[model samples]
Target: MGQNTNIRGIVQAAVAMTTVGTLTAVSATVSRYPVYGGQAVRYAVAAVILLGVARLRGPRPGPSARWEWPLLAALAATGLAGFNVCIVEGTRYTSPATIGTVVGSVPVVLAVAAPLMEGRRPAARIVAAAAVVTAGAALANGLGGGSLPGLLLALGALAGEVCFSLLALPLLPRLGAVRVSAYSAAAAVPMLLAAGLAVDGTSVLRVPTRGEVAGLGYLSLVVTAGAFIVWYDALGRIGADRAGLFAGLIPVSAVATTMVLGLRSPGMAELGGALLVGLGVIVGLRRSAERPLAVAAPADHHDPAHDEEGHQDQAHDDQHPEDRRFVAEKAADHGV
Candidate 1:
């Protein structure tokens, strides 16, 4: 069962990488539209897609009580709006590849925050591996060159991602990954729109070009809505930290896509960076073995079948209120 849980975690990580691909595409495509107008278009489309998904997930009368609501809002807000701001604002200082390399630092951020999020003492191996990954990210993105600002932005984004996921943990059990993600995406829409209005004024409301429309469609349907659902569902089954390790693949896939389409060519530095990222991933997976997970976070509320037979070091006993609460919390925790 533990092995299966790990495998599911790997699956979730892979799905997460795929989701990030869609996001990266959306980011590049949005560039085709005028600055402010493009952002408004992106959010308007994302909002509609999330609204549809919210309908399918069904709504609860109130917010998820699994955690304090305000904290959860901050977490969701970071992912939804903060990530965007970081990327957009961060880009002003750096190139996209530099962003990728910096974004790759997420594993390190996860490793750092893991203690707080899951109550686990990170092993030495994890620390070493995280260092390697960060180094790889720096090299991959040309940190020594004019890419310094971009690298900083990328690191900031990585940090934001770490905060978003860790802070989001408590909310998962009750809000469900679907509702939580949808609400986050939905909330970002207005803030994004406001930012767009501030920058582009009435221009943001104008009709988009054909390329812009295509980009919008791709982002709304496939990237934001579809991939978000898949990624979070996997999160429910597995756990966030495990799910994050797969992010190493995003830069690889992104670079490959561009190369294949003749949009860009790979240079020696980029190739070396890929090698470092690969090594970092290998080290990360290895580190997971050296240390026993200190604190078992919990399970997903969406699937009771995932509950371990002897969960929370307690036998299942309906008569005991404490035991029942343990099981309930375990079940809702979404394998955190």
Candidate 2:
């Protein structure tokens, strides 16, 4: 493995774990504030906190460039709107365990997309690693226990996540992580509010409990604002493939948290599934280091964790001859 790729692999691993952790925390909190409008309110609040931080530290988003608006739209669609709605609705339709399994496929998506989008091919080792991750996720979902729709909902969430990762690419380099997060977060509010108003008019006036308020505060201040900066910065440096891998951590955290809250203990299948994902990530990432041209920027120069690839080119076409032929055309040179 080249030193550069090795570092990126580590970054992606960390981000993936953190991503899962954030989801576990936020989702548990959401049990308190289930309203549709809550999405916007939380992000709006988070954006404010991010902006405050931006003022104190230098902003991650620089003067900026062309990729801002489209990236913002992507964030609004994937992160703010679709992501929230899907999770809530999906949960209503299916089981969280099943959904977690399906959502876990993101690493596979990235594993496939990375090569094709980069206008290159993935090392055989990477493909193997991705396959392992995919299989592990399937095992987790299948054994974790849920209905068919439950599985589908999980897949749906994964679909949204894939879209979010691909779409967020273009914005990272120009905006920096924090600026992009804050802007998209702020931008998402109007739509969230509209959804709430359209679906439930009294959403605005509903009384919030102490837990709900605290949940909202955490979602906004910590999850949306704080985590995003770190995540986006990771995305910018390491490329989405590595960043997406962070997703595996979510199920692990969820299971652990569930146990902690005394909701349920991790089942054998879930544990096996999580272990599979962890193994797959380790294999794929380490293999990436060994392969030539595996990451965006040289890891030695910049933190491998930085996101460098354009979000649009997030696929790892190494195994997918079935993928669209022109994926590479839109690809930005990562870490150049």
**Winner by TM-score:** 1
Tens digit of lDDT per residue, candidate 1, span 257-292? 667667779678768867876787676665243332
Instruction: Encode model 2's per-residue lDDT on 176-220: one tens digit a residue.
Output: 566667777887888778777776776543667787787777767
Please give the lDDT score at residue 240 for candidate 2.
Answer: 62
Each model's lDDT: 0.61, 0.64
Q: Which residues of candidate 1, in runs, are more than 4 Å off?
A: 22-26, 57-61, 64-69, 144-155, 236-238, 287-336
Whose lDDT is greatest here?
2
- For model 2 the local lDDT of residue 327 reads 44
The window of 10 residues in a row where model 1 has the poorest summed lDDT is: 292-301
TM-score, predicted candidate 1 vs. hidden true structure: 0.77
